[model samples]
Target: MLSDTDLQAIGLTLRLATTTTLILFVVGTPIAWWLARTRSRWKGPIGAVVALPLVLPPTVLGFYLLVAMGPNGPVGQLTQSLGIGLLPFTFWGLVVASVFYSFPFMVQPVQNAFEAMGERPLEAAATLRASPLDRFFTVAVPLSLPGFATAGILTFAHTVGEFGVVLMIGGNIPGVTRVASVQIYDYVEALEYGNAHRLAAVLLVFSFLVLLALYSWRPDLRKT
Candidate 1:
């Protein structure tokens, strides 16, 4: 019953969420590992930066990012010089914004998993003459599968539901940046409650399923 526009929005949202989750996994891993194992004084500061999005308003964060990626900002200048053009109002812009906005959701769960694992597994792996990288990939990662799942689910869901950040960065260009959330907003603003309801209901069911999967498989991911 959904229109093509609605379907495109949903598909784009999935694409953005998927891209954001993957980037978070790659970027958040080292950060979480360091947070879990490091005794450095910088840990607190770095962790605070990672967790800042949780407390900051999405619009505020997005505004800063927009400014940074705008023509006058350094990011824009660098991108322009590199021929990458401006990032704002683009699909990749949404991905970048989603990554920053959903960072804490990914980090906290994975960091908790890594910390819960302790150093015992890595130490044991080392005793077997495994290299540090090998120990992490073979021992640490395998033991933290639940946490990775938790992080991925949370990140994907959060990105899908994002509004202010995506709106600021990507605008409402259909098939480009008009994701489900923005589409729903457009429906409401135009007094199209029926369409809004349909989209909202879809997201509602999806979110419920994601949470159900998370809790059913790893309730402790919810605890921390």
Candidate 2:
């Protein structure tokens, strides 16, 4: 049976995933919009950078982040000067890592959605005297709801499963950085197979159910 700590880990994982998803939505939406609309040659390089984490080893990414967020690192120094101190091995650090790790997941979907939309709708809106921001909120965003939903689900699920990056940067600080994935690792390391199994099963079922809802709910709207 899963213990109270195990349950807390599950709750923390969900909270972390939720926070990451929300931040990605706010941060990624504009980037994706620009990527879709921009025609500059530099956009390709920028897009590649945004997508690099998808292919890079988690440890490599985590290692770099660990250095960057360490006490003597740039982020740490800036935070320390401001009295915030190094964020590493803290909840905020976990949030930052999860944001970077999950960014591409959120961006790519919204970008694809915008690209598929093309300029037709925007042009049509312009004829109706709509401003760019107005058209985006009134036309583009509503049209991209499905894509956003898919992206949010995938990003949250991916964040929930993160281990290497979180473990390396978060240091398994209980109730702060000890997310479900790290807790599962702790269980396995102590040969607590039953606890690990339960946690793994819970995550599996939860992810599957969310994905099943996203994929199976709309055969008609999918054409968009």
Lowest-sum lDDT 10-residue window in model 1? 215-224
Query: TM-score of predicted model 1?
Result: 0.96
Tens-digit lDDT track of model 1 for 1-224: 89999999999999999999999999998989989999999999999999999999999998999999999988889999999999998998888889899999999999999999988888999999999999999999988988899999999999999999987888789899999999999999999999999999999999999999888978664354
Per-candidate TM vs. native? 0.96, 0.96
Cα error, candidate 1, residue 133 (Å): 0.8
For model 1, state the Cα shift of residue 33 in Å: 0.6
- Whole-model lDDT, candidate 2? 0.90
lDDT for model 1 comes to: 0.92
C-alpha lDDT of residue 110 in model 1: 92
As a whole number from 0 to 100, the lDDT of residue 72 in candidate 1 is 98
- For model 2, residues 1-224, the per-residue Cα lDDT tens digits are 67899888988998999999999999999999999999999899999999999998999999989999888789878888999888888888899999999999999998998998889998999999999899999999988887788789889989998988998898887899999999989889999888889988988898889878878864556765
